[model samples]
Target: MFFKRGMLVTQAILLNMVQLLTVLLLAPLVKGWINRSNALFQSRRGPSVWQPYYDIFKLLRKDSVIPEQASWIFTFAPYIYFTVPLVVALLIPVLTTFPLFMAFMGDMLGGGFILSLGGFFLVLAALDTGSAFCGLGSSRARFVSFMAEPVLMLVFFTVSLVAQSTIPYIVNQAFAGPALILAPSHILVVLAFFLVVLAEIGRIPVDNPATHQEPSMIDEGRTMEHSGRHLGLLRWGADMKLFVLLTIWLNVLVTPWGLVGSAAPLAVALAITALLGKMAVAAFLIAFIEGCFAKLRLLRIAEYLGAAFVISLLAVITYTMGI
Candidate 1:
């Protein structure tokens, strides 16, 4: 019995490593595909779909330049920024619904806190640099985050109300049934979460990832001073963040159908493939929306987020009323 338990632990460790590596490697590919889709939407031939991977490679080989005024926070921020999303990736149901090694780390609330930690460090890193652009970007990011996080928590709460657990895998399993999928509360929460995704990922009508202008930047602004390997880590971390969030949106909230429930090799492989296909569909839809909508003014962003909050509240009300 002891030997059997040891083997089970080993298998769990291996599965966790596999899930981590898959997210790290595939994150850039998702970003590249989105950029390519955006380019196609504009009738202009964009850079290669593999451009993000190439960019990361090039940055890795180059040297990072630090501002003389920067402190240790600036130097260490990239690692912190990069590591936080990795933690989040592990917590989420990426390749399987079965809990891996770190499955007990926390639930949906813990995942949100981890993400917030990364964002907080990023803001501190920007402030440490004392660059005008970085400061401006940090302020804007904080403002948006202030309005967005509450709605996000409310959305999570609504899901927890139905699932009766804050754990993501349990939440996914709970909502996987056809009955929950068609519920009015579930539909409202999904819509609210979708809006949150737009704001969180810096997509259209929220913030533009493609723009570098001082007036229009948010996430990019925080990294304006970073270059070479530091920039690579930050950008890769951003990609990972995007991938993790999108996986949650698609696999947990929307479909929740293809995730593997067993430890069988074939089941795991098929689950990964299903996740990739779903991600591709999501990337295309995001690109289409980006092409169709213009960026909202910074002040107007509050209204956008406010609408999301209202929708989330309605979701809770719908659940309570059995609507």
Candidate 2:
């Protein structure tokens, strides 16, 4: 019995790791597709789907540069930064639950709360580097996180209200449960989660993903001193971050097929396909939104996030009031 249990745990862990890396590998393709779409819109030639993979291989082969004045933390930050989000990306149900992950942070409410921990460390690690860009990015990330968590919690709560369970799988099951139609709270939560997605991912009207704006770029502002392998990890980590969020939304609203791990090979294959398809759609939607909106002033970030908070809070209140 002990050996069988150990084997099961090992299999689960290895499967999670593989899935995490697979998401990393797919990240660049997702970016490439968006770039291709945007390029077509601009009437410019776009790069190929293989571009991101090539870039990663090239970056990995190159030697890394570490500034002499930089603290050890700055040098080490990229590895931890990369791996944590990868773990997180796999922890959430993308196509299916891995079982062990849900065993640990199983509750959607708890999982949402746990993201703040990652946000906290990401910002702190950036600050530890002591670079102005890093500091600025970290600061903005902090603010966005503040707005994102409550919205996520409220969203989960709304689901829980209908399902009577905060476990993601349970809430997912709630989709077909009582109150299956669009509830007011559900609508508010969805809107709030969508906005939170933008802010959390450093999208427009909150922060620009592709900007060197001295004071405004949230994700890139950090790691100004990182180079080569470190930069690769950070970049790769970012893709995982985007993928994870996409997975959460996909599982929450779209297909909750496997809240527990799939048994048959065919089922797992189908689940993987469903995940990739959803991820592609999400990436396009996010890219579309980013292309349509101008970056907001740092001061106006509050207005955007404030609205998300209002929607989220209203979701929670509506859920609690059973309205």
lDDT of 1: 0.90
Model-by-model lDDT, in order? 0.90, 0.68
Candidate 2 per-residue lDDT over residues 85-112, each given as its tens digit:
5656644655455444544555665555
How many clashes does the backbone of model 2 have? 0
Cα-lDDT of candidate 2: 0.68
- Number of the predicted model whose TM-score against the real structure is largest: 1
The segments of candidate 1 whose C-alpha lies over 4 angstroms from its true place after superposition are: none
Kindly provide the TM-score of model 2 when superposed on the true structure, using C-alpha atoms.
0.85
Model 1: per-residue lDDT, tens digit, 82-176? Answer: 99888988888888887776867888878888987888988999999899999999999999988999999999999999888878888898888
Tell me the spans in candidate 2 whose CA falls farther than 4 Å from its real position. Answer: 1-18, 97-102, 109-119, 176-181, 257-261
